[model samples]
Target: MAYQDEITHMDRAELEALQLERLKKAVVYCYEKIPFYKENFDAVGFDPYALETFEDLRRAPFTTKQDMRDAYPYDLFALPKSEVKEIHMSSGTTGVATVSGYTENDLKVWGDCFARGIGYAGGDENDIVHVCYGYGLFTGGLGAHYGGLNAGAMTIPMSAGNTKRQIKVLQSMGSSIICCTPSYAMYIADTAIEMGLDPKKDFHLKAGIHGAEAWSNQFRANLEEKLDYKALDVYGLTEVMGPGVAIECMEQTGLHVAEDHFWIEILDPETHEPVPDGEWGELVITTLTKEATPVIRYRTKDITRIIPGECACGRTHRRIDRLHGRTDDMMIIRGVNVFPRQIENVCTGFEEIADWYQIELTRENSLDVATLKIEINPDFPMDEIRKIEDLQRRLEQALKDELATKIKVKVVEPYTITRSEGKAVRIVDLRSEEEK
Candidate 1:
């Protein structure tokens, strides 16, 4: 039997008819069980009977991350806690957090979705998949673990932080498929090279699935070259049922959304209105298949465009481009939009600079300033302060040209910045002005 999303390849009437059924049931489910939904529906003068199709979804209030946090423990759950078999919370980078509960069936649904994602990326029963994302409260490790198992691959549940040991396992076990955040994967590839092992030749690895943190095309190409694998982008969020929500096939066109299971909308962040197809906007998701903790029109701050053309891979579900940047993370500097990925790309352009860098944005003397602290390669000449100063000045000019904003670049010694086993925080916005 094919996955639910495959139905979109069917006749248009058939696909729409199926979606109509799911949307109707989801609306009624929310109206009856979730107090927040019930109140919002009443305030909008909407009755459950009125929402019989996907179009009626616009009448419902959008669900924000705050709503999930407000509900907390079990308020978002469509079913009773007795049916909830697992709970996963979002990694809090800001204020109150959102958590998701999974019923036994919900786990199976995710496993199936991930299994499909893995298969699309060339994973099979013969491959040994090493999942390095942290376990515990975070969903990446378990998501990859169960997905690998469901795909019938040999599963390594090596959670992140032990870099040296992970390298040994990958080398000794002859692992074929690796799964982790792009940064950790890069670190592992670097570790293997440092141990005098050519990662491409020493390992039988053929594929990698990378996500959890935003990355750039340059970083993706670097990792692919280091590991000698076709790195496929995987996307998900804890609030939306974790990793494997969408994936890129070998075509590498963009990530295909599991549209049959989740209703997705691209909306203007300020107006909360759906944008025309092919436009960039915040991604809003409503879980059509989830039972334990169902959400309706949850606004995901992730920014990406939904491409609707038929992919060469034959998947009918729509594809979303690799995230450009988050709506929340887009920094305004002198009226120009700047992203951390752009800064990293600029730093990596110089061989003399190490990858360790931080971008500090602050206000001084009524002008916004961006200070970039980058580490210099150890091989640089010791008695070359003038050369180093020149390189710094050149980098500042290059960044100013690329980002269209004035920037200050400082070159520090090697190993000056802290290395992380997980996602690295690169941006620090420090303005005395209060956020609205």
Candidate 2:
């Protein structure tokens, strides 16, 4: 591909040298402009100029989401509001939403990152990019739009919702690329079948870039079979410049981090110490090229381990395994730590179940109980009571083996669970409501 020639194929030594130079500049930029960073560095007795190698970064204090929230609107921004051309905010599910300011240059860099991602997914100038990510306030929409334009592809800012119209556009406009949450992609595939249109035959889509939520390999396979397109996983956070942070190339082994733009580190979540390569830990990122809001050692909390070598695609950037789950998203149920992704992996692995599922947590007689409500595959013989019961028993056993705890598996009819146009909500915790 034309886009894979330069930085993507740069020498490993050359890439590291470039990263070190950019890292020093980014540190100096933050220390000089952002008071939060300056105070933290001063308190720790660390000087930005003294950062000679990547190892020196450890002396700097870590920046958490809480730090961003405490900074709020503009405290973390390195540039003034006048210089910032755009602003984006986090979903604020945890607490106060984090605000990200972007200068014109920052926006350009963002577009370049997404363009690289699009190219990695086999996108080119002739393709029509249909963006279904939610626009306004959310970064996924506009971020993708910019990327498509950057790739010289015809960009469509369809945003989210109105499933029927979205399908119509896909068929009528001959859109070749789709960008949305993986759950929404499945919902679209289901809706297309209901409309009496075969997604593979009726649409011109060749690839899908899915992110903003965690999904399993089985889910990806199901989507590919249904939509007849290559499904690529994209990873990003609103606070970290959104969906272009890293993306899975055609290799599909792991997501290649944009090392030149963002430096990555894997740290033990509890100890705050670096973990060995290939060991799962929390992901920490430092923005190297961002001018408006340069984050230094921002703790992403997403868990994944780095792949030790270069990808077959010849990209010098390091790749991280698919995210297992977030540190905060781990739930303590009946003294057993469980992540939604783990349950998702187990549930989706069953071919008899549909892609949609919900994990409900409740307390019964002072004991925590987990109920896995999944949709039965529409193709399954639902009328056969014996087959349904047998499937349920097997599913329950699989969940027990994987989770190491007894769980209730409820198989619902197709389309029983509420569908999401944006990020899918998989967990519903009623323990807090019950406590009250």
Candidate 3:
């Protein structure tokens, strides 16, 4: 299923060897050019110049998001600002923003990384690629744009918002590939329906590249049903090079990491020790070829396990299971741990609910309370009060069984919840300072 291969189909031993070579080169470059990496390496008594094997990476000090924030504007750049051509950064609404820059070569590498993803989605020059991710500061929009250009496709820079116009463009332009967040894609489908357009028939979309947030396979299936196209996941973050680190091919088995460009590892979130494949752990990564701002052993905080064995698609790169959830995203309710993903799984399981759902947490009576809000599907028997009551009870029971913690469920009328134009807000915590 792989497109003509020069790098993707490399033999396992050959691929690992190439990875080791790039890993060493990047480590040495970072240690010499960036004082930040050198200081961290010296503080940990880890010698990057002497690193001979992948195991040595375990000894290197981690680069956290806080570290990037502490460094602020340009402290982490290995190259001077003059040499850096472009930059992208996180919203950093929570704290100081994390900025990543790219040299000329770095930009090319970013495009190359995402172009492989386009190939995985079966995209070619004949396809008209429409990119709807937000532009400026955010990486999703430009990342997909670069990929489409690299793949020799007719690419459109339709960066986010304007759902009505997006649908019209898709209909008139005959767009075959759509790139945006999973939530925005959902909004586009709903808007098209509101305009009395059948997304499946009216749009010529063949694939949907959805990411910028964690999503479940059940949600993916629902998207496929609405769009009538194979839905794929593209993984990336601004801290690293965005939207090209990994992607799900037609196999839809797991997301294949671009091992040649990024070294990925699963580690115990608490202990930071490496975990084997098939066991859930925090994700850690190191940029192998980034020139402007290379990260060594960056702790992503996201949780996933590696998929064992080779992919049927013939890519030597390893694949990781879709993100289960983030450690920071976990909440304790009634002395029990719960993840929004768990609640989402339960919500998506019921056939009588809409694709949009949210989890809200509040503190009351010295206890943390969680409430799940879901919208009723049009197909649900809304006229029957008994059926509605039964559905609500069933959802509550399903949440209890899934999380082993009781959560209140509120089933509201369709279109009651606000739709998202970008990354969906899945969780809302309103607990005040004293409540915390």
TM-scores for every predicted model: 0.91, 0.97, 0.98
The TM-score obtained by model 2 is 0.97
Computed on alpha carbons, the lDDT of every model, listed in order, comes to 0.82, 0.90, 0.90
Task: List the pairs of residues colliding in candidate 3.
Answer: none
TM-score of 1: 0.91
TM-score: model 3 vs. ground truth: 0.98
Q: Clashing pairs in model 2?
A: none
Model 3 is weakest, by summed lDDT over 10 consecutive residues, at 1-10
Q: Write the per-residue lDDT of candidate 1 for residues 1-436, one digit (tens) a residue.
A: 2233354355556756777788889888888887888888899887767877677888888888888888887777877788889999986768767889999988998887787777887777878989898998898999989899888889999999889999889889988888898888888887788789999888888888888888777678878899998888898889988998888887888998777788888888889888887898889888887888888888888888888788897877778988877877877777888877778877777888766677888887777778898888778873698999899999999999898887788888876677678877778777765531
Rank list by lDDT: 2, 3, 1
- Give candidates' CA RMSD values in order: 2.7, 1.4, 1.2
Model 3, 1-436: lDDT tens per residue? 3333578888889989999999999999999999998888999899988889999889999999999999999999998899999999999988999999999898888888888888888988888999999999999999999988888889999999988899999999999999999989988998898889999999999998888998888889988999999999989989999988998888998898989899998999999998889999999999999999999999898989999998898787899988899988999999998878888888877889987887889988899999888899978878889998899999999889888998998888888888888999988888898898
Better of 1 and 2 by TM-score: 2
Give the candidates in order of TM-score, highest first. Answer: 3, 2, 1
